[model samples]
Target: MHRRRELVGWATVGVVLCALAIPWFLWGSSTVVFGLPLWLWWHVGWMVLASAVFWLFARRAWGLGVETADSSERASATASVGDGGGSR
Candidate 1:
């Protein structure tokens, strides 16, 4: 329900929708899914799916809290700048 989870959920939906609706070349064969062509699914489907699932699991494990590493890194970097807005 937070920004991070919301973004990931939207991303998962977007990728899956794209895979089910878009078509592309693959070994000169037309790969299909749900009678439609798979574009993102061809290479990133499983990975994204796994990531989505993992994130969902992680969210639950962490009591549905947003403790992503990137957010922490960003916060630390900002704090280190001390509000001077580092310009280098």
Candidate 2:
């Protein structure tokens, strides 16, 4: 259930990411803003938004779908690092 919920969350984010990948509403429009075409501004703003979304995901949910080592291995790795030994 938890994994399903996470997947759904990611799916929604993915939809938002893809749906705005192109500024379809600005196509064939002659609008300009601050000496730049509106579509170019849309792309610049979209990139900023995408970067923010990715930054938040990296900070909060980076391992959502990643397979990780089991507890014993994680414990050993931590112990090794704690003792100033590199995990081999």
Task: At residue 66, give the lDDT of candidate 1.
Answer: 50
Candidate 1 collision pairs: none
Residue 27 of model 1, lDDT score: 44
**Best candidate, lDDT:** 2
Clashes of 1: 0
Per-candidate TM-scores read 0.25, 0.69
Q: How many Å off is the CA of 62 in candidate 1? A: 27
Task: Put down candidate 1 lDDT per residue, 1-88, tens digits, no spaces.
Answer: 2345655765676576566443344645666887655654555666666577668656644422355645544665666744332322
lDDT of each: 0.55, 0.73
RMSD in angstroms, all models? Answer: 10.0, 8.1
